[model samples]
Target: MVYLDNNATTRLDDAVLQAMLPFLKDEYGNASSTQHRMGRKANEAIQKARIQIAQSLSASDPSEIFFTSGATEAINWALKGVAERYTSLGNHIITSQTEHPAVLQTCAQLQKRGFEITYLPVGRDGLINLEDLKSSIAEKTILVCLMAANNETGVINPIADVANICQERNVLFLCDATQYIGKTDTVNLQNIPIDLLCVSAHKFHGPKGIGALYIRRKRQPIQLETMIAGGQQEKGFRGGTYSVHNIVGMGEAIAHSAETDWRSIANKRDYLEQELAEKLKHVAINGEQHDRLCNTSSITIKHVLSSELMSQIPDIAISSGSACATGTRDPSHVLLAMGLSPDDAKCTIRISLSKYTTDGEIEQTIEAIVAAVHKIRSNSPTWMLFEKGLLD
Candidate 1:
């Protein structure tokens, strides 16, 4: 199948799998144990992986990286941990309405407990207004959580600007950078001034269930109260034995992506969009066209159900939104936040690519999409209106 769902997750790279094999077999030992050679080896491997991940993000200190199950868990730790640690400072937090469910759901839970949350709305192009953010900030605002790139539309937010504003105001900035990392070259943490950042390995050709959160270190040393308290693991911030194999695979994946040129991948993706869009008259590009990940394109076809049409292309795999919620009827909250009507949101399809995708695959995908669209529209009365010249 021609997989176009890189935004959801990726097939783990061969190198990543190779790196993980030793850890899963003979190197299997609890990194927490230091009494034996086997344990020491595991400990060293984990530390090496940590440094690799930190270096990939341009983090100065490896200790600032905290491994977690994935971006969702990291986001949870950032929001809840900071909120609890800085409760004496304030009870208000700021975020965008288009944030992932992990951030929004956590914010909802906090709101239930009386912590005020200000959800800033975005424009029709999926951009949060900086002026709106300035207006939302108050003395009680202690934290601001925003995503670097949206999962569904792949629109990259102005995170550096947001981070700078939050830094000037002394409000902690938490960014979900999961969808942006390996797909682009914007991982420089220095430019962003982010206090906390989240990234998932699976989104970038690494194994699932492995990710990291970068916590900035300063004189104040951003202290977060432990949520998963137990065995004093992960500097006592997170408690549990580390998944050595998954971490090794993640490190290998990031290392490879860092060395590879992403512009080529971007060109291939753009070619696919250009080729298909030239033939599809009812097509509309969703989100901000320029301020997006190079490997992603979210498009809307008028009067078409994206999921239903995509299923007709048996050789192609695509999506309507986040794979987590693909089977649901509820419209994408991300698209809705960008002022899209429910119908518009439901008719949208997300095509994501990776460096491994080939030119031939892209061409095949375009043909598949064209066929699918034709089949679906032929039976659609809404499509008939346009053909009958009744819809201008």
Candidate 2:
């Protein structure tokens, strides 16, 4: 299958697999157990992986990084950690309507338990208004959780500006950077006054179930209450035996992404869009093209139902929106919040490329999409009426 669903998850790198084989087979020791040579090796590997992840994010120290099951867990840790630790300061949190379900659902759960959450709306271009953010911050607001890049639309948020506002207000800033890393180099971490940042390794070609959270050393580290209580696994904040193989794989993936040249990937993504746009009409790009990730495109066809057409092109793997909502058939909340109608929302599909994607594969996917859109539009009664000028 032609895998254009890099946002959903990535195929594991062969190098990552090779790096992890020893841990899965012979070096199977719990990281917490430091008595034996095997245990020491496992513990050392975990520490090394932590440093690799830390370096990738330009983090000051490895101790400031917390490993988790994935970005979802990291997000939960950040939100609940700050809320519980600083409960006396305030109980209100702010985030955007375009965040992943991981961030949105966690905030929703917090609301059920008496916490106040303000969901900031995005513009038609999928950008959160900075002025709206300033107005939304109340004296009671304790934290703001905004994603660095949108998972569905691939739009990059103005995180540095948001961080500046948060800094001046003395409110904590948390950025979910899962979709941004690997696709683009992050803004200097030292310059941004964010308190916490989260990333998933699998999104960048690592094994599933491994991710990291970066806590700024300059800020009063969020004193989040632990979601899991056990032995002091992650410095008493999170408790569980670390996965040796997964952690190593995550480190390998981060190292690979950081070292590779990204300009080529950006060029390929541009080529895919130019070729597809040339071959098809009545298609709209979903987000601001200039501000989006070089490896992702969210496209909407005037009359195409996303799943129906996507099903016809079995070789090209893509999505209707976020990977978490791919099979739901629900209209994208991200698009709806951006003012797209339910019909337009259903017509949207996302194509996420990676460094591994090939030019030939992009051409094939474009050919298939061109044909599928034509097929769907030809059968659509709405298109018939609109073409005949019977309906505006």
Instruction: For residues 1-392, write the lDDT of model 1, one tens digit per residue.
Output: 88888999999999999999999998999999989998899999999999999989989899989999999999999999988888899999999999888999999999998899999998988889999998899998999999999998889898999999999999999999999999888479766689999999999899999999999988898978786888888888788888999999988898888765688877987788777779887788877455788889888888788768776887788888888776678999988888788987888999999877898999898888888888888898888997889964
Kindly report which residue stretches of model 1 are placed more than 4 angstroms away from their true locations once superposed: 389-392
TM-score of each: 0.97, 0.97
* Stretch of 10 with least lDDT, candidate 1: 281-290
Task: Give the C-alpha miss distance for residue 78 in model 1, angstroms.
Answer: 0.8
TM-score of 1: 0.97
Worst-scoring 10-residue span by lDDT in model 2: 218-227
Off by over 4 Å in 2: none
RMSD of each: 1.4, 1.4
Cα lDDT of model 2 by residue, 1-392, tens digit: 89999899988988999999999999999888999889999999999999988787777788888899999999998998888888898999999999999999999999998999999998888998999999999999999999999988889999999999999998999999999987888546877777899989999889999998888877445677886898899888788888999999999899888765578777877787777778877678888544888788888887678888888898889999997875686799999999998998898889898888988888889889888878877888988987888864
The lDDT of each candidate is: 0.88, 0.88
